[model samples]
Target: MPLFVAQYPIGINSHVEAIILQLEIGSDDVCMLGMYGPGGVGKTTIAKAIYNKILDHFEGSSFLENVRDKSGTFDGIIQLQEILLRETLGMNGQLKVCSESKGAIAKENILRHKKILLILDDVDKLYQIERLIGGFDWLASGSRIIITTRNKHFLQTLRICHSTYEVKELDDHEALELFSMHAFHKNKPEEDYSNLTDQVICYAKGLPLALSIIGSNLHGRSEIEWKSALDKYKMIPDKDIQKVLQVSYQGLDETEQDIFLDLACFFKGIYKDYVVDILNSCNLYPVIGIKNLIDKCLINVDQFNKLWMHDLLQQMGREIVQQESPKIPGLRSRLWCYKDAFEVLTENKGSDNIRGITIISPKLAKLQLKAKCFEKMGNLKFLLVGNVDTCGDLEYLPNGLRVLDWSRFPSSSLPSNFRPHNLLVLDKPQSPVILDKIFEFRRKLEVPQNTKYEDNILMDSHSHRKLSHQIDYSSKIDFSHSLIKPLSTLHAFMMDSIMDYEESYNIIVTGKKIPKWFNHQSIESSISFWIGPKFPTIAVCFVFHLVPLKDSYANNDKYGSIHNDEICWNCHVNIFTNDHTQPLTLQRDFYSMKCDHLWFYSNSHSKFQRFFRNMMQGDRNLVEISCKISWWSSRNKKFAPVIARMGVHAECICHPPNSVIIDDNSDYFENVDDSSDDN
Candidate 1:
């Protein structure tokens, strides 16, 4: 038995011991154990540790490293079987089994009589296992065979293992300790380098292989060199780590490879089903391709069904795309680097090879491109532009586009000749171009503190033209009309101001009415309703009317900044029914610079049905439903949230016997004059 050479196995002890317990190697029965996880998760290292620990207890032991790679060599499986036979039988020279019959003869005659421990490292295919180990029946009782693979499906399909263990990434403490050992030659960092050490650990993200490679590369380097290395890693991954991760990607087929690249470039952290739908429209078998990726430990789907990949693996995939025409941004299959994507568009350097492009810039800059920039990108399928003001005629758009999520689009309208016949999703949020007339007064509003404008000034009535110059209702009407025509071809759509925690836009709308599609409507903050029996469907709506700041306050520099007095109103709705002791609570945050309403509806009945059952408990008689709404302002100590008019609406299959009414104790809308002072 030969000892394995692992310098620092910080997190492998627990995994090895747990897998050993799972295998129950002490039992008299023959056992086959499998260790599986994503690439570079330390599966082989743990297997090697286990093999070396129990080698002396067995009659003989053999560890076959890199079975997936070695099998591709000349007569690989045959040579592997011969090596296994010679090691277990205590032979001195290499045993040559050129043919299948010869290999089987050696396996059955000499190797079957002894109790042996065999470890197969990095097995990817089922045929490799079949040819290498055949069966446990041929080995003596109490014998054990361990297999380490990236794909769990291979083990299930072969049925060669009685137990399987998934090797997880190292925890924070273990990752830091492991990284410190290689970087600083100790288990803990010195005081001066503590923060730098933490940054390195965060970049590694608890992946042992990444930690090892980076730590070793940065060992004994100065502070300046460490900082430079970390900065470089953001754009380009360490080559040593990328080489290991890229092997799994290389094993994928053509369509699967495309799916992987697309996810790496654009769809990471997106909902898996949503990405699958978009990819399916592009003729990619995302359903099977995603499964394969998961099996290979290249990607993971969390409990929320959102797809996530390790940062290193994602970087590796992007690096692969980056290497294809490294100097020429136009020649790559995917363009995600902001500099590259911007250059490709502004310079008309895009080519037919470009499949996807994402431009996300934090700075406020207008990207002016020639109208024919996308003319050559006929193969483009996915396009996402965020926080970028794109201008130009844009006379032509590719007909094969599947997703066009351009936030803050600069054009007044899409070109007439541009056709998106195959488009599946169109998300143009905070679209200033579509609502040019409504947003024109965003910077010029000078309303007094106590003035009350007529509802028709902003409402959907013909009288809207009376205030056309101050606020154009015609543009709003045109915007709404133009938006409705594209709903037939889209799978999902959203149109609203984009507000994050740090900043908000100045755009505001004065409308206060809910959409007509909502069957029930209310203007008060809280409402109580009775649901009759057999009401199958229910939908909820929330409408908030924003009050603009006074001209005096807006002009003052100290108070003018939106951040100084900006308040984020968080609304919580509590639903009470007669059946349950506790009320069901739903919460949403409203951060629009202007007035906005949120509608909650389900295209599928299952989600609504589940919600209805949980809230109503299938009661046959009339059930009282009460919703209480409250709001709190964020970051404003003196500013209180006042509801000019808040509403909750419920839609169902049939109307209740009694009409919805406000709770007598609730003072949501009563004494409107005093309510403003209370906030």
Candidate 2:
């Protein structure tokens, strides 16, 4: 007999021994054994240990993990069929679906395997077994199918020629041994801590998972620390094993709290670095925090840095976070997608109740802004925009803003002047049209100049032509390649894409963002890049857009020329060029044609305007550059900004670009009488 090295009482000793007994060549018994229990109850472990013990008697053994988690039902059935095919038949052949049904294939394959031990993990639905192993005739006299499950009725409904056994919890002695190894590193608690150990054992209630967690929680602590833990245990409200496990979670630091919640709610079986990346977005220290979790025994982190928590623990953590701060503003929480964000904001519109908002989810159904709701947000600031149709109709923004990030907005139609003047940080200001609007706003708001309008007009004219060319291309091409296309249709296409992507692949990247290629350098260089003719690409042509400037510098060398003279505006980056499309000066009124692209922005005392041109005709690459910010207060915390995405539009937009569009007063309607307005 193989040694039973595992100390945990997995509760399948009898079944495993029965399988071994039946596997004898002289045994005439044809019996199937099914081991079942709730998730995380050690069914898989028991079956494996048993299988290893008796594999020598059978021709082969097979194991399937997450049979129901795969993409297609047909795929799982085929996988099982292939296993039986190669092992029992000693023939390597792919199972082809003729009439292509899973049931037919399963029926044919099960009869071919003889004296084989098959272990199926996480079988939940009854139909899954019926389609795979419903038939009884296929089993050889000693063949066995050992199934593990969270639902017992799932097996009872199948009602095949199989007897089921419920794997129960460990007894006190077995639980104590498991706990002692983890807690005191001995067979029993240390002499001095016997009383506290007894208290811990009573809380564990003979459950293996609970004992294991409690033991690890108490590991290496002094007697005082152990007493402190015991005191905490006595206060647990539910006194359930899960509640006891949650005590470890409560002991985690604030960062650990956020990381744990994010994992439980957002991802499972996720790669380590991917989790790290998500945590890094919130400027979290995942490395140290994860180690703390592993050491506390609340979670497990493998050599691959893949962190996993017992489902019970995960459920507890999620419930605690949600219940404790159901409505606390700025409390650490997550928005699953842009739609969730919109739903929250829309549901709570006109109230200054929400404290902070994060746009963690990328893909969202398109949303059209209701004019009244846009005008009512008096305190909104932090926003994570997605590249989907959700950004359309965004105009007015709260003036008390600190951060503006449009990296999530995939396209370039966002208005300028969206930046609040007191804004401290601006990231990825790549669109030229938006940049120009900021500079224009800054020039008007900060630096009062009467003659600067003409200079702004000159730049606007240049950008106008480039924009027109792209619009012309869009008009000429099929429906897909237009930039100025209506937001509604784009949203519909996106919705269809979501369904298609979901059906075909299990992986979901949160943002509905299309890849962007245009950058500041590419725009300034007048280099054209195309995304697809189906998608309207950024057109690369330089035109003069208003820019916020620190000082007035002219490209013209001549000090007194009337037409090519130095035109001083709040322009930051230069809009002049060696070659003029016309006379390098326009005699006509440029603002007569409304340029939604024209913008103005301000950064403290300095300002600049970017004259964004057209889409790059070919491929343009967004150059990745890293820079760090130092905070003197938080131990001089320094971190680089993630260069999310970049695009080229035109000239300088000031510090905090004015991306807000003025709303027409006709749309504002009040539920109350005008008495409140008068008051």
Candidate 3:
């Protein structure tokens, strides 16, 4: 048999010793060992290592690769027989698969008396292996057979397998060494890449194939390139590794495949029983499908009975969904990412192809929901949202929904026409829609420290959104849980300000145009608005296009894409009464954005019970806002390498007394040039 090549063979000696011990070469009884693991965990590599290490001990040996790839038909099985016989017995190339127990005892007896070692690699279906090579009775005493499969159950049930070797993922140290060998041409990462190396290892999660492919993909790349590649891999996994892992997934039936994808997209880490219940409601036959997934090593149930999947496999599933409709998320069967879900609902782009959606903790301060958003999502069976601020109550819902777990539902009751006949889980945690107390503050509002203002202003879908909970009111959302996110919120400054202000405006950039709601508009770099008793409190909002920073290092093809937690654009909103006075600047902070997006420094809660009454008393003082955007790292942001790329002027709007209105529509937006671009 031609020897198999084991790439980056780390930790193979122990495996070879274990397999050889299981074989028991000196024993009188012949043995067949089953080797199993998920794809890319190095099952084939270990088998090859075992084969090369012990081939000298046996008189005849054969190592057959990719039995799964060639087992599609009886002809393929016959081909596998030919290779096995030719390698083990020096027989002619022609061989036939036995239709019954040992086809032609004369042919089978050729190896029955010879002490041989044989390996069948990548066997998906056990029946194929059984038909190609019968039980150990056909082999001589002291002979050994080792068969490898992705499905552990295949080995567990096969009585002929005297022992089974469950090949586990590489340990951290070995994984790092193997990865660095490909990534840095050394046994360890370069001096300054310890953290980056750790991140790669963590994401790869000990899968040898992922390590090798990702390492090679990032080879000779700069730190920035590594970061970019890592970010992209999360969104779209390594194509080669994905291909290797998808073989097992493709072996599943249609319903099993759906269950696997569902778990990958939304159910990972959820209790196994809970997942089975939800999937059962969808008529997916979850009991059997989940079992199939477990048997195939697609998912695992931990001690708590929660489902866990390999990170690469989960990413691969999501990428499969994304590939269905690369440019339009609405056309895909599932939606989990906040950006994709937000875009589909806000743009009214939902389609019947979408089967489920889970939108959690949207990056926007307030997410305004309209009733018509789900009009086209007739096939949507699962919907879950948490920490989402919506304008008002939902007016409609489909009857086919099997799961509806929405936090912060804005209505006092479910839609009048909506029915719960098909509902399985109606989860509403800390919801205030049942008996909410809607209170109106005095036109003058003062926010005390350690107190939360209502979020109505942020959720209002009308013309006058309230400052604090302008309309949607339950709890105040805080960014305190995150390290870098605090630098992006107005609440960071609201609690400690020396002077009491009625309102605070947080900045966000999206692929949305500026709404035509502000009374005063400007086309220049700055805007002036008059605030009076009729409209004392105000919030600044605008949109700016992202133009490239000239001669900046972060202008490569993948530079615009980055981890939101690590990088951001520092924007300054300077407020001035006139040119002679120093501006009362909105404290400098960072917000994540994309190049095609517009900037909107919008949403605030609470009425300023106190304002610059002295400054506002005469001549209807015009509050001038000058906004500029620059790129910066979340780390050492104060000393950021600034690139002045955008200058946007925002129009200020006053909140009314009773009801709040916020129009998140695409209208009356005048595009301002991103002056930072070389163009």
Candidate 4:
């Protein structure tokens, strides 16, 4: 059989071959070699392979496996030292070593003159190495020492093991061969099981332990049996592989265990800073806890600072949670499964044990909820309830709630007595009832009066209900392109063009954000940028949030909320050709807005040719142009600064000169507390 444990360690990993090249077996100095990666990645096999190849050159050698588990304490260290002395000295009985003396007597008596080869396999802590081979001054020159570990930092901390190499997972080709060796007893998969083998490879994600265990289990089974087993493994992983991968997790401390399980269960692929904020709010000292987890090779941080772990590790953590309350999910600490969350909220089966919950069903089903659906859960910390279609208002939310992201929230306002002093994030991106205002602000342009708009509102924690005008993303507005909401990408600004403009795509290079950002800082902000003579197609995209629309009278709430639904405001878009006071107006102001919208005004190449012809009729050379958005009350009264994310795009152009010259002339109007609309 070609099983890895039974057969010679050949063709199992490419990293083994690469590492063998760096061993320098014939070198004249003591070489310290270290190999590190997550558990079950074949570190032991590679060490054995190198040891066997170079053992003939050494006077004596020994390969000690599982040193981390074997040499944990002083008593354990003495036991391991006795074994090391017996094997390397070619002795038949126990050596003279004690827990109090450590390896002091053995180092002098056993290895005073001979050149030796020593391999410490799976060494997690430093004591294992210190006791087994202390200082290594006793062994003769040209001797070699090797250590294999799951923790890279464990080896990195030792100056002796400076030549550490990271042993990553297998590539697609290597993974396939490794699986085939165990299943088919050959170099490749059976002809009939090619696609199934590919699926297995994808599931294993190149973890050798998973591949071998799963492949061996499915060997000699019929095609139907293979299909059934694969389906079964989707929900329930194999016990053999889980046992091996969970070893690292089982070694963590209590707080580190909580941090690891939390990341593996809920925060995989989430930004590190955001995860830290959420976990720190729960009193989990995540800074040192996360470092411990990394040192153990249980988790990793990607280039973008997102936390991710091996798929098997993540599955293992979820399995641990499932075991916490196998039949009851609400009794568990965290809930991300939609069905579990739906049952807890719908049946009110939640308890104070529930710390965090998220219900993001793939199909987006609306669960009917009572006014006090979350009353029983008193210790709830974070909630991301989605699409609760209810008639009456929500009565109570846990005062301990910290992060609230309720999607499609039906109520016009939060619970009457809900105090969010501990709330860090209260985000309701597209909830229809956050604010009950239909403020549609646009340029001064005439349109039909009968235009339907979604109701949008904004409120603050410090003020009472106040309705304000919002933009309606309907066809009645003077927009040349279709309206799309929730683009979902941060800093996503690009011009989608129709015609080919690659012929003249040269742009001046500058070190700034193109189509510069003027959102979130002011109600109205303007910028000027230099445009070429041949104006490429431009796309104007903006993200505006008038939710809890701020007013002059409301004491700027910490969470920036305002009471009332029907907010009244007008948006003014003016263009300037290097001018200070007057505007080159080509459109009219739009009235009545209703929701937080991401407005993408796309223009065809022909439309761009015609637009520049109209706006810049006289001065058509390469010049700086400015676009401004000003917000005023419907009755021409000045309003608070409108906060929105606006980005300018030129689709066919790859690079453009960026400029951000903000002009904020919003000091003329007084704060308006007169609620009586005199329009």
- Which candidate number maximizes lDDT? 1
**Cα lDDT of model 3 by residue, 124-223, tens digit:** 6767766666654677878888989888777767657478888878899999999999999899999888899999999999999999998998899999
Please report, in order, the local distance difference test score of every candidate based on alpha carbons: 0.64, 0.43, 0.62, 0.59
Best by TM-score: 1
Instruction: In model 3, state the lDDT of residue 333.
Output: 98
Off by over 4 Å in 3: 90-107, 159-161, 362-364, 433-679
Best-to-worst lDDT order: 1, 3, 4, 2
TM per candidate: 0.72, 0.33, 0.63, 0.66
What is the C-alpha local distance difference test score of candidate 1?
Answer: 0.64
Sliding window of 10 residues with minimal summed lDDT for model 4: 503-512
**293-326 per-residue lDDT for model 2 (tens digits):** 6545456655534456655566666566556445
Q: Is candidate 2 or candidate 4 better by TM-score?
A: 4
Question: What stretches of model 4 exceed 4 Å from their correct place?
Answer: 1-13, 73-75, 91-103, 159-161, 386-392, 433-679
Stretches of candidate 2 off by over 4 Å are: 1-29, 71-113, 224-679
lDDT of 2: 0.43
Ranking by TM-score: 1, 4, 3, 2
